[model samples]
Target: MSPDLPCIVFVRSFLHKPDNIDHTEHHVRQETPKQIDGHTHRRKHSSDSEKTLTVEDWATSRENPHNWPLAKRVITSLVVYIYTFVVYSGSSMFITAVPLVMQELHLSEQRAMLGLSIYVLGYGVGPLLWGPLSEIPRIGRSVVYFGTFVAFILVTIGAADVSNYSAFIFLRFMQGLFGSPCLANGGASMHDLYPESQFPYTLALWVAAAYCGPALGPLLTNSLVNNISWKWTMWLLACMSGPVCILLFLLPETYAPTIRYRSNAFNTSHNQNNNNTSSQDDNPLAKLKFYLVKPVQITLQDPAILFANIYTSFIYGTYYTFFDAFPIGYPPVYNVSTTTLSLFYLSVLVGCLLAVAAYFTYLSLPNYLRKHHDNTSPKSTPTHTPPTKHERHLIPAIPATFLVPISLFLYGWTLRPSIHWIVSIIGVTMYASAVFIILQCLSMYIPSIYPEYAASLFAANDFCRSTLAAGAVHFGIPLYKNLGMARGSSVLGGVSGLGVLGLLGIYYFGERLRAKSRFVERLVE
Candidate 1:
């Protein structure tokens, strides 16, 4: 009942178990309506309870999200990976074939880009619903994700079947709306499958999966279009969603709190059987309904919650918008085709790998600091410095804060239509490295600060970033045509340089800002 009880309840829940807990026995549950995170809740050994309770298997654990017995966690990750591929294929896969769509629909270049825009719009809005929906029991995340994606497939079919251009865009928007959950919920799945210590690395691999879809999207869709037709792109994606839907039934519920609540129910009921109570109670059904109906409210309604999310969104989303400028701003100026363009995306993958190195490099900091402290300590006693945010697990997005613009300037000026594609590729490689670093930072930062609502917080950010990226795509081509490629790219480069500066200012001021935020301050304390 005390204000601090949520934290206490959550900690106790993680460190201990419900075998040692019961509905009639819990002081906290009686007074506080909120349940602790199930993942954090550990079932302790006790004479009364025989249930071998663990949210995840102890052997594979976080060491390998990929290493799960192919049947359980790995299958879930792969199926979710398939969902990601479908969602992104709806975006980038349509890109090369935009001319085909425009020809059929009688739309202009800018207008045809709307399909891609609509898909991204889904990426923005889907999270608000999906993230909260995933946390609720009975109606677990996998169900919500599978159900919405099936709906998305229907919407995709509608887009394919539409005769009217206006109706087409509208249907595409609905597709995006349903598809957004994959990205928002996918991150949560990655976390559920991995541990905090392995989170950064596993996250890097997951990030690659999400982006890999975009990179590989064109290849797969191009082959599809080459053989069949562009209209079939959506059709193929819809077809793929079917198998993924089937896979969801086998996907174990990874939401920790929900897992714990169910385990408790199983135990309490079985124990009741042992006690020889012969009764059929309506209350269990009522509780099941209660669990199903519970909602997580994280709307932009609360001023404090809104500002924290929005502020984080802007700082993070700006990078996404900044990177979207890459393809049109520099590639064509260097005379790269859509087919060759996929080569450039490899940089993001490379950056993701580097980010793993950077993260482990960071994980070593505590050890390094401890050693330094030991050497410098007084003989009789030891005094140590509290790890600052900068020095602690938050590693500087290495080589990126500088690499982005340098890559930009190199590609911008040197990239003439006549120049070899390699020059621009090299430039893009740097920019990709920087962008991937930014992506890594944003991904890790969201979860690090708001571990409970990691999906929602990132969902809030996806809207900001996706919206800005869509807006930039709308205006970028026109700006470049009017202003000329070199100058246009120069202007963009200058703005991006400013973004890097913003990153610096944010990194320096970021800790202070979070320290001041009542939500985060409360969490950290």
Candidate 2:
């Protein structure tokens, strides 16, 4: 078995034995051979006559997620989408309540801001632990999803009732930590159910849910905070998550390795062999090291990946900073109440919806059909050929890179009493749309480039982005306070403009960078 693959083989002894048999019945362990350069090499077993199951067999089996009924897969996908939304909403749902929390706890603005920043930081850290555990066939994704969510509910309930500043902050971090699995693993779960051709569409919907969750958070809690109390925000999160937890119970295990393992265990029990049991490395400590250490190593060693992560972190930081920036930019200029300001977040949802529509209309569907026709067509040559398959994934990001700076500049300059607030909102919508495109492109493109490290790359991506966003939450208010809206936003816009260069460089030169990467070299070998 390849260590690169997230699978482990085990040997087990059956309890029951035939009365005439003096020897113990041992299960035959099958190791799916690794595929390199489009060729598969199978390992030789002790008994050539013994029936063996291969990875190809598992791929076509009814137990495989891709082989499941359409309705089952759709329902499962919906559950994951909603679960992600509920968890992501927790990060920003408390923004409107910061003032109330400050007043109630007798805290300063910076101290109160920890409620949001600390939670964001927790998301950055939780994935390092959860990402590895979910990859274990014995552990699986469903357990991670259900278990942490229950913990999230408990932490949220505690956060709602806590009065001490320290306890509230601690509970807030716990909320993010416990709620992060969906954010870290949601894409992988979707990948498990769909082929590459169809995955981008599902991922688009998933990304929309993720983006819209925080975007809609303030809107959902605005009325509650204005009418009742800030604590209701936490209570609302708990209430919304409770039913979703029940729905998760109906979600079958989607991780292919876990399903394969279970099926193998059943088969081994029924048909036992006297052949010596073969197994992969089963050391827990070694497994843990691979999961935790590999992602950081890959990110640092691969320049392309590192730059991509940095760009993503900047975009995410700007997005979270908006949570703080909106209050500063909107209320004073528009003379709007908190409730009215919350409505502006809808512009983000509008941007996300627009991006999704455009992705399907222009990119995902057309690319999928093109690939399908190429596969089925009689002629060996196709009319259209992209520069590179992976690079083609980044086409939308080209325009999006320029849009980031343009939108940021427009947003920064337009926040004046003389200017209509709708104009600034158009900037917000543009920024949101650009962010959605850039992130979605990177999310798909990065994994495609490094298929072996997809899970770890995602964990690293989440950690880097969330860590920056956490800092942004802290510094965002102060940036506006000291530099004022126009200057502070220009600073951010200027930083984003650098991403335009970085993205363009990556788009044109990414293949060369990959060819130089030590990690990529290892995969080639």
Candidate 3:
């Protein structure tokens, strides 16, 4: 072992060690370049395999909101309704502020009213954007809820701080733009929470909440306007918004496609490890493209959806017109203060409460009993199927449809100063009740008709209702002025009569229309 010999031994040991160069080179020498490349590829493949992960539903997974506990679904639904209540309340709360707004801003009555009308128009158009984003499996309901909710609050605050009428109008419009997701996506969220069987009842409560919010809004803001500045009314909205924003964050994602996407179970691509790159659009523009095109396509192609949009739009227009009509009739005839006038809006709320009660007793209980009976009945076949997959609950929408015309006529005739005010209020209540019933039926039925695209279907309905309501809000006041409450409301009543015919047309022919469309399918089993 001379020193040179020792150096040689150290070099051989370093180079030829089994864990280092020796075994690697031996394999390198044993194979051609292609074979060596193949061997290297196999090693790389084995390394990649360990990094790959699979997503599957476990037994009793909570990924599906339908499987969430009753408490979670109920709380979440209540939060969503509260969010809607705030949005709609914001829409009408400023009605009391219109006179103050005109006075302070030195604007005309028409321009002052545009604040509210434009806000509603924004709501109509907002769904054109938010509706599609929400349906994206990547974006989902929770994100829309949180994002829109925060935007609503900020816009409401901006509305309070704006000094100019134009800025005020812009902010109000932006407020509606941001606030509309709750209205547009709410029914779809309810659909996520419950199975098809439970949607009608839940949707009825939801629509009731939404209507009642607008009714209650004038009541709250009347005090704010009378006691505080009109700016405070906007501030009141901002204050109310804070808590809803918090709750929206707490809500679990209820959009099914989104949940499936997150769980990786929904994407059918073989390489989900690519982070759903193949299944979902990485570009915002691509997502927007689908969002914009699909709902319009659905609305244009589907007769049932188009009819529902038109039917609800008429009802919505009439409802907004009442905001002006009630104020006009009572202030001049009864000489009521704005605050007292706001109380008259309660007629609609009373009607809503009664309709809700009637629904629970007449529709909900019977449907539940029928369901239980069918499920337990010996007549149920060996397959244990329930009797019918179609929503027999919609049977009520038909008879209730006629009430709109009757109530409208009654509301018109009873509004004269010669008549007692309570009599007129009763007429309004009847109209409200009928409208509630028709709307609940439509909301529930439309979603059932297009379960796969419930959000888009709902967005279409929202767009129709809000756009018409925006036009009505501006034109409705003049209409009452031109025709007087009696003739104006009578004209509306006659229009409502047309709605009854439309409803009848839908009731008899709706199924045939739905069956022809490929975009939608029957909801139930």
Stretches of candidate 2 above 4 Å error?
1-56, 265-284, 364-386, 521-525
Better TM-score candidate (1, 2): 2
lDDT of each: 0.55, 0.75, 0.70
Candidate 3, superposed: residue stretches over 4 Å from native: 1-59, 260-287, 298-302, 365-393, 515-525
lDDT (Cα, tens digit) per residue for candidate 3, span 1-525:
121111111111111111111111111110001111112201112233333223233112466666788999999999989988888888888889888887877888778888778888998888778765676566778999898888888889888998887888899999999998877677767766765456567878888888898899889888878887988879999999999999999999986556656776532332243342323333444445544555577788877677778888998888888878887788888788887899999889999999888876765455567667556634434433332333343556677778887887787778767888898888889888888887887766664555445454566677889989988987888888998878888888887787766766555556556667777553223
TM-score of each: 0.72, 0.85, 0.80
lDDT by residue (tens digit), candidate 1, 30-102: 1112233321222232343333433233222333233445467666777777777667666766765676877
Relative to the unseen true structure, what is the C-alpha lDDT of residue 480 in candidate 2, on a scale of 0 to 100? 90
Q: Sorted by lDDT, highest first, which candidate order results?
A: 2, 3, 1
> Taking the candidates one at a time, how many backbone clashes does each contain?
4, 0, 0
Q: Highest TM-score: give the candidate number.
A: 2
C-alpha positional error of residue 183 in candidate 3 after TM-score superposition, expressed in Å: 1.3
What TM-score should be assigned to candidate 1?
0.72
List the RMSD of every prediction in angstroms: 8.3, 8.2, 16.6
